[model samples]
Target chain A: DAGVTQSPTHLIKTRGQQVTLRCSPKSGHDTVSWYQQALGQGPQFIFQYYEEEERQRGNFPDRFSGHQFPNYSSELNVNALLLGDSALYLCASSFTVQGYQETQYFGPGTRLLVL
Target chain B: AQTVTQSQPEMSVQEAETVTLSCTYDTSESNYYLFWYKQPPSRQMILVIRQEAYKQQNATENRFSVNFQKAAKSFSLKISDSQLGDTAMYFCALKRSSRALNFGKGTSLLVTP
Candidate 1:
């Protein structure tokens, strides 16, 4: 069984540009969460999606938004990106809010570099 | 709001030795869960171990165990017979009931051969 998978392992973008990163949740998983990990720091929660709607969000601004499809795959879209937006975007999947271990399995992450 | 903290920025251990990583969290809710996740150079977050707040018995995996002190809100991870492959960034996370996890800054573990 495949774990969570993310597309475009790496990306480069200019300031003010928009980018969309994709993620496919692990098989049998129903919740998807997005996080931003800056260099030398921990992953910060961006938001979480369940049942095709956003269930929770973090400190991120309106420029950062996400969507969950019927299949539980997710897309993180960033608008008006800044140089500080450059970071590793991680996507995690869990069976559900009440699933075993309350553990989240993460993908390899998309490395975004903004210049 | 819940917060997780890892005071150790980096740690190193000789191969075959053991090491402990410290973590603490703050939450208003009494019922919650704590976890340890390992992120290797490949950047995949793997669940190392977890402990439910109500479980007084510490949670343990094969070579990984957690010293969970519920009263103190402390959860530490101990890696035994450490191997070079064990080197990675370890993050302590907290999740209140029905909430998402709040992760710590992460401790980078280096197991030297």
Candidate 2:
């Protein structure tokens, strides 16, 4: 009955460094999505994964990528990060059904700071 | 491309008072969904309410309700009996069919005593 969970609640990395953040979807959920929320702004979608494959992506660059495991967990990897990359990384999960609410329940999020 | 706009950058209301946050989205899809999400200092994105574009009756949950105007592409959230616990950033989001959510910049709400 646990909700979505994320690891490394807070991270500090330097520019040009690489970091990987992990997320575990809620029980019985199949879809996972990643978002980046800069300070004082709403979260912007990064990508979505279903069935271990990326289904949709946002306007992010090649430095950002993600993977979904068979167990519905996900990892977001950012390479050669820049200072602007510092933001709160949020992971959300949803149960995909024909008539269900399809609401994306979110985790507490990982705050990444690139120096 | 879809755009969600929240003109209100910040708002404050006394405890037990009611406040409304305005949101407007642009989309041609007749069947879509609008949502209100609350993010507290803890930084957890909580789903407050949802309204399907086709449902004209609006959606309500406890003290939260949405005034959804499909023709105008406007979805406003009203929080009744506001509590200090309700102070947070409220985001308006829109999703078409099964795509990802498009969110507004968000409105920071403060419920004062």
Candidate 3:
């Protein structure tokens, strides 16, 4: 069984530009969540997608958006990227078993560098 | 809003020895979950162990274990027989029902020979 997989192991974008990172969740998983890990810091949740709709979101601004396809794959889009947007974007997948307390397995993450 | 804190920014331990990392979180929810994730140089987030709020026995996985103090709002991770592979950035996270996980700044652990 394959674990969560992310595309474009690394990406570089300029300021004011937009970028999209892709993720294929683990097999048998339906929920996808995105997180941002800055240098020397832990990951901060961006948002979660369930049933092709955003289920939960963190304090991120509107510029950060995501979508979940029918196949349970996800894409995270960041518009008007700033220098601070440079960080490791991580994707985690989980199967919502009992409503909560599900174990989330993560991907290798896409390193985004906003130049 | 809930907040998780890892006071120790860095920790070191000799190979085959033991080391403890501290964490504390602020939350008002009665039912929730706590987790420890390890991120190595490769940058993959690996779940080390987890604990449910209602459970009192604590959670353990191999050489990794958690000391959960509900009243004190403290969750600390202990790694026994530390090896070089154990070196990584350890993050403490808290998640309430149907909520996103709130993670601490993380503590970097380095195991040396």
Model 2 chain A weakest lDDT span, ten residues long: A94-103
Name the docking class for model 2.
medium
Q: State the DockQ of every prediction.
A: 0.65, 0.68, 0.81
Scored against the true structure, residue B48 in model 1 reaches a CA lDDT of 92
**Reference contacts recovered by each candidate, as fractions?**
0.80, 0.83, 0.94
Give all candidates' CA lDDT scores.
Answer: 0.92, 0.94, 0.93
Candidate 2 lDDT, B2-93, residue by residue in tens: 49999999999999999999999999788888999999988999999988888889899999999998888899999999999999999999
Tens-digit lDDT track of model 3 for A1-115: 9999999999999999999999999999999999999999889999999889999998899999999999999999999999999999999999887666278889999999988
Candidate 2 lDDT over residue span A12-54, tens digit each: 9999999999999999999999999999999999999988988
Per-residue CA lDDT of candidate 1, range B81-101, in tens? 999999999999998987778
Task: Residues A21-44, candidate 1: write the lDDT tens digits.
Answer: 999999998999999999988899
If ranked by lDDT, best first, what sequence of candidates would result? 2, 3, 1
* Model 3 alpha-carbon drift over 4 Å, by segment: none
Docking class of 1: medium
